[model samples]
Structures are given as structure tokens and as C-alpha cells.
Target chain A: MKLRVIGAVAILLSVIIASCQSEEQQEFQRYYNGGKIIYEQRCQNCHSAKGEGLSNLIPPLTDATYLKTNKAALACLVKYGIKETIITINGKSYEGAMPATDLAPVDIAKVLTYVTNSFGNKMGIVTSEQIDKDLLKCK
Target chain B: MKKLTGALFIILLYTACKFNAADTPKLPIYGNRDTASKVVNGKTVIDSVYQTIPSFKFVNQYGDSITNKSLNGYVYVADFFFTTCPSICPIMHRNMLKVYDDYKNVSDFKIISHTIDPKHDSVAVLKKYADKLGISGNSWWLLQGKKEETYQLGEKSYLVAVKEDSGTPGGYVHQGWFVLIDKQKRIRGYYDGTDEKQVDKLRADIKTLLAETNTNIAQ
Candidate 1:
């Protein structure tokens, strides 16, 4: 009887874990879809649909190292334009300045999350709170 | 009733043939038209003679003067944009770059990028901008000329619109058109430089123009 009770507990725990994972997956999908729409409307013209960017004129966001290391700067850059600085990604330098996007904090977060997690990246999601904090620190 | 049906069918066939003949694509020769008298089948007929693009001079990114003389016997594409443009210029630049790449190896084909903001985009600035875009050699030229002359060329030569506006982001407004000029310096086609599909059409039309040039030379 004790073994049967333990087995029931194991089944319940597995079911809860599965549901939790699915819920997380669903939330990620929501962020990704919303972020894709925003990116297509605003960012795709310069950065391209896959974030591959134009040749030497714009920097590619596909580099996982760049995206992971510059998470805060990415959020800030989205809110405010990066002027007077040349950004280098994966040893290739881009000279053009990134224009500031007039996106809200929530939308900025979604775009950041979408880019970071896309184009062969798995850097995870960026929250609106993070974007708000980053924007506060933008120069 | 049968005879009426036969007559209607004959009329429809004639109309369709006439329409198909009219639909044949022909390059328009722009500018002032002049009438020339011709005797055809013992009858006097008047035909219109079309003019070509007028001669002008502008300084290229290298600070060298480029004139209509330099563009003689060549097919070219021309457009207007400024470097610091915050909006449509980049899209146009990207599209123009695609056209440049496609025709870079072709002889006697050129791309002229004239800056509407000539004051800010001097020879030095245009040179730097061209360098940043990796545009080297003579296939493409970044031109900076007098504001009045550039504006006039935009309206008169390329048949594009340009003006200044304080409320606009770039402080100036211009159309995003790549005007295709044939070897005779006549405007052949205009493509929206910001649209990829239009740029594709521009590429295809370039091929057609080149074929037409070849056929003329052969003749």
C-alpha cells in the first residue's frame, strides 16, 4: 500500500512538472510572436528579417556572444540611438550608427527577447522591467 | 443572323490584333518633341522627334568633375539621397547596392548617387560614406553638387521630386526613385528604390536595355 501511494505521488509530480514546462513554453511563444511583429514593423528594414543585417553598414545580431554579453546595452540601444561609437561584432566592425527606436518599454523588451533568442541564439527572454532599468542608464 | 455573327467575330479579331500591336513595349524618348515631315507611299506624313537628357556637370566623391560627356554611350541609373537621412535613404541605399552589385562587372553601366543635401554632404563626406559602403572603383559615383543645380536636375533631368521641409526628419524631402537612362541619355524607366520588387524589375529592365543597346550596335 505504501509503494502504491509513492507511485501515485510520483505520477502527480510528473504531471505537474509537465504542465509547468508547457505553460512556460506557451509564455515564451507569446513573447516571441509579439516580438516578431514589432521587429518586422520597425527593425527589419535595417537589420533584415533574420537579423543578418546589411553588409558592413549594419551589425548582425546573430552573434550569441555579442547578444549575451551586451544584454543591457542592447536594451539601452533599442531605446536610444548609438551615436559616435563603432560597434564590432565577431571581429567585423560596422560604422553606421543605430537609429533610436521609439518603442515603449514593453515592446522594446519583446524585441530584445526576440532577437536574443533568435538567429541561432538561446539567450532567453528580456523583461520590460529590465528594459526600464536599462533605459534609465542609457547615456 | 449567321452573317451578323461572322461580321462581329471579324471585328473583334481586328480590334484584338490592333490592341496587341499597341501593347508592344517601346522606350520613350523624353524632352521637347519636334515634327519631321516624311513622304510615305507618295503621301506627306509628320513624325515627332524626341530629345534626350541635357548636358550638365557635377563633382564626384573623388572631387573630379563628371559631365554628360563622361556618360556618353553608357546606360546609367541615378538617384538622390543624403547620408544622415534617418528614414527612407537607408532602404534606398540597400536596394541601390543590390543593383550596383548586379551590374558591377558590366562595362559602360554606371550608378550615380547624387546627394540632395550638398551642403552637408561634401566631397569628403560623400567619400567617407562611399568607403563605408565598400563602394570603390568607377562603376558607382557619389556626387555632391550645388543645391540649386541638384534640385533642378531632380526635377528636370531625372523627373523626380525634391523640396525642403522643416517638419520632416531629414529637413529635406525627395522621391526614392532610381531613374534608368539609356545610352542616348534619355530617361527609360523609374523604379522605387525602397521596394525590393521594384528593384527586381529595375534589374530585369536593365538587362532589357542592355539587350536593346547590343541590338542597336549590331545593326
Candidate 2:
């Protein structure tokens, strides 16, 4: 009986420990407004408020089709503006070289994260580290 | 002599007609005149421009339930943000408070702030934040609810950008915009939530929208 009681207590403790060890909550640092202030000051003029590209002038960020296939292209576009180039969103096409902005890598990460997440487009999180890697690749 | 006589006769005739026309039973300019009717039409068009509020129910800062119906017939500014945001959220929120303070007593205006990060930004946390901001009464309402719903409302309904990002400067992220909703709840325009000059433009537009009568509702 003593052994059984000890065994039960041990099982209970282990269960508690297991519960506490749950991995659902991961430690990840999010962007500060995803460079929202920087984006507004610099990007809102062309991107518009809702991330919906201006009619025929710019491509909407919520373009589900483009988002599915052009993740790298999107990053590259932000890092290096598409001057005198055209990009398509959804089915519509846009022609304009969005000026290559002078934002830091972290700022780029935040703004890209914001654009990806907003405008009915829900891409995963973008990190400054990722931005750094991506920037290096571009160079 | 003949030409002079003809000119004088013509002048007299013109003067007489003009005098008679002025004296004829003229329509009252105050209430029932063409100019008045045109002014009335302009007001009607202005009022028609405001949009209708969509139906939604969410928790308020006081942990109380609030809905779109509560904001019926009121002009309010709506924006989405999370508390721990380390970026434009603070600046945007400060600007929103400024708007609220200026228009709290106006009766026709109100403010709604929705949290994009519902999991972390519970009613309790939002309540604390609102208290910190000194929001009391019905003038300003802080809301939090299902994350997807908030995102949809921000992007589709309000025509502003919002999303859930784990890599934001904080743990969450959203747009830096203050969307202007007229009394009828239509999106009149969007202003830079973080820029002071843009905020001023927002204020002027708000005043203008308020002055215009709510008229059109695009179904």
C-alpha cells in the first residue's frame, strides 16, 4: 500500500510537470508596430491605407495569388524598389517602380510583416534576422 | 438727334422693365426660394454620404458587452492596435485621445478602438489601458474580441489594414491609421494615425463630415 501511494504521488507530479512543459507557447519577439510609423510616413502614399493597391496604379497586398507564389519576390521588391517595372496582384497588373526606400533591416522587417498580415493577406511573421538574410542575398 | 432720341427711348424701356421685374411678386428668399431649395439639396446629398454601421458585438474595456448598435447615429473614429506595441501604436493612440478629448462633448461624435491582439489584450488589460488614458463614459470605447473578426472588420469594413504578426516590434502588429466614420458609419476617409499633420487633416475632415447631413447608404 505504501508503494502504491508513492507511485500515485509520483504520477501526479509528473503529470503536473508535463502540463507545465507544454510547447504551445513559444518565445518570439514581435515587431514594434511592424514599422507602422515608418511605413505610414514613407509607404502609405503608394500602398494606400488598407494595403489595397491603387486601381491599376499599384497592386493590392491582399492578392492571394501573388502571395502564394511570390514570397521571395515580395521581399526583394521591398528591399529593392521595382523602378520602371510592373507587378501583378490577383489578376490586375501594375506598372511603376516603387522607389527603393531607405529603411533599416529591422524597419523593413516590420513594414513587410505589417503588409503581409494586413489587407486580407495573412502571411506568417517576418523577422529582422530574416530581413538581414534577405538583404544580404539581394546584395 | 435721331440716334440720341432712339438711345434714350431704349434706355427708358430697359429701366422700366428692370424696375417692374424687381417689383413683381418675388418668391421669399428665406424659406421657399430656388437658392434655398438648392441649399437643401446640397445638405441632403452631404448627409447621404455617411455610411451605415455594420453589426458587431465585442467586449469593452470595462469587461462589458458593446455592439455596433450602441454607436448608431454617432460619428466616431476607429483604429486597431494592441497594448504591448512598441511602434506606431503609442503615437496613434495619443492622437486618437486628442481627438476624443476635443469631441467628447460634441454628443454626435465618439471613438472606438479595437484590439488586434485579443489573446493578450483581454478586456481586463484593455480596461487598464483605457483607465490609464482616462477614458470614461460612452465617449470612447475600447473593444476586443475574436482575432479574425477584428482583422476582417479592419480590412474589409473599415477599409484599413490590420493583421496578426508574431514578428512585429512588439508581440503583435497592425496598421497605423485612424479611419473616419461619419454619423451613419460610412468610411469617409483614412488619415495617418501617426503623423501630426495628417491627424490635423483628419480633424478638419471630421468636422466637415459632421457638418454635412448623413444622406447616402450604398448597399
**Highest DockQ model number:** 1
TM-score of 1: 0.81
True contacts kept of 1: 0.46
lDDT by residue for model 1 (B1-219), tens:
999999999999999999975554356555556899999999999987655678778999999999989998889999999988876877888888888999999997999988989889999989988887878999999988889988988897777899888888769888899999998777788889989899999998898888788777787
- Candidate 1 lDDT by residue in tens digits, A9-121: 99999999887787668877787889999988888877777787766777788899888777788877887878858888999977767778789999998888889888899
Docking class of 1: acceptable
Provide chain B's TM-score, model 2: 0.72
The C-alpha stretches of model 1 lying farther than 4 A from their native spots are A1-21, B1-45
lDDT of 2 by residue, B1-219 (tens): 999999999999999999986544221111111221225644633222223456898999888888888887787788888765556765676667678778888887888899988898888888767765567887888899988888888777776778766775556656788887765456667788888788988777777666563332321
